[model samples]
Target: MTFAIGIFDLFTYTISGSIYLAFLGYLVVRLHWVDIGALAGTPVPTLIVFVLLSYLLGYVAYPVGAVVNRVVPRRRERHPRQEFLRRVPTAQDRDYVQADPFLLLSALQLHDKDAAAEVTRLRASGLMLRNCAPPLALGFVAAIVELFLSRTPAMAAGCAVLLAVGFFSLIVQARRLSHWARMKTLELCFWLPDIDERYRVDRNAGGGSSPNNE
Candidate 1:
């Protein structure tokens, strides 16, 4: 599962990085920094160079993802844990209110392999969508620039519009996937004997519902 998650992350990075690289490549060609004709003639070597550069840019693109994340409106400004507590009923119990949802979920995963796998899958996909947003935004900008530079303004305009729509949609889907993963974690925790016992103890000690501290 860990390896699978790492591969998914790599794939996300590569995809986003490729877009960033393409944007840079366009600028380089436009500025005459590299000869496009020469690159085309040495296709194999150029492809190898691009492949290596994409992986390197993949690592660099994380900062862009961080910037994009800040620009995007999330459920809460603080940790997602706070949002989970506010939204998830199971997280409202006294025991869970003060507990870290991620930690609890990790503990739950130890005893349930299937639940662990599912959560991992959701998280990986959410991360991919989230990371992709940055490059898509950059692609939109690149397309707009291309509109001014290209002879076919209509095609460039259409590409820009599609990139704009895709960027927005990825942001929405990323948040949804993250929320779904947290909800699934809480739902699965409901069946865990240890979690049940914790709830039982909290109810017995508190004798009522706990107020949301946030």
Candidate 2:
């Protein structure tokens, strides 16, 4: 039962990880710079270069997507449990829309190692072991299964390539999210104003005027 829960938990967090890689691959092809090949036909060199570019792009694209997916939700989620104190929802797994961001922000700033304590504190507090790491492992498992179970050489190769792209993207995104969370810690901690300042001068929906907001 625990293992089954673990598997389900892993899948939920990995949403959007695969799709990002395909998008990244398309971006790589669109930006591929090899002009030596014929405009109409891909030459051996161009094909090789394109493949290399695709591989490299997946490395970057996946990470960027991961950063965007994780951080945006973290920063935006509002707390229903506490009007002033909210939790980060990604790793929480209880209620998505009800999550508060500040609760998460405080947690990350405390637990992480690289002063990334801020980011790590935020990266799905309870779900670190439960959520973040498993999908990466599963992606690898799927890749291996495809490589061995495939019957035809071409199909096997295609699966291998697609699987690689997808998995690679997930990892990149994971790493990038951590990085962005760290950076965001710095940004929110030092640069951004308190929520009151951000919404300055306006009366809140709860009918309270913000201090220094005017």
Candidate 3:
């Protein structure tokens, strides 16, 4: 269970880690600087070069995505609970959503005391361990495959774009987590426990106990 949870947490970074390698492989093909035959001739040095370029390319894509995020205005959202409830009507649905960090945020919003504390614990664990490091290592590993395993230019470009999308999605999730954390902190200052009333209303409306009751 723990290993599965950790992998779920690292999913985005894991998926995106190969962007650098794919981009590097694509560049290698486009520039005509080195071919498979030459790489075989000088395997070790060529691999080292490819590895560095792959990691560097991943870093390069990060700033480009950041800049684009800065330039674009984020859409305003309100009544998040209503939105969440609309989508997650069953305990089964909530269970699946729990894999997402958004589950933590939703718990805070719903005044789930346990979830709030878990968020703080997660925050203290170090971002590199919890967030960035997995992706960095994955990127390096992907670079190896891109350099040695893949050969087609089109496939390389496709992989690069897919990884870029995953990388950008992780960036978006990080921003949402930050925003939700701030909201949770502010709400803490003026804490209110409305769970009893919420439960009462749910029962009166012929609904069963809320999923959070678990």
Off by over 4 Å in 3: 1-115, 121-130, 133-149, 192-214
lDDT of model 2, residue 3 = 17
**TM-score for each model:** 0.68, 0.29, 0.32
| TM-score of candidate 1 against the unseen true structure | 0.68
Highest TM-score scorer = 1
Candidate topping lDDT: 1
What lDDT tens digits, residue by residue, belong to model 1 across residues 64-141? 665676687765533445665677655566354444456556667787977876876776676668777877787788
Model 2, residue 200: displacement in angstroms? 28
Encode model 3's per-residue lDDT on 1-214: one tens digit a residue: 1223243223323233345455455567656876746555766666565545544444445444445445535565333344444544543223222222344345464766665665554332222122443343345446546755668756655665665555556545555654444344333422335533544465578655233200
Report the Cα RMSD per candidate.
6.3, 15.1, 13.3
Assess candidate 3 and give its lDDT: 0.45
Give one digit per residue, the lDDT tens place, for model 2 in 85-130: 2334232323211223443355334544355444544443322322
Model 2 lDDT-worst window of ten? 205-214
Which ranges in model 2 have alpha carbons more than 4 Å from their true place? 1-104, 107-150, 191-214
- Give the clash count for model 1: 0
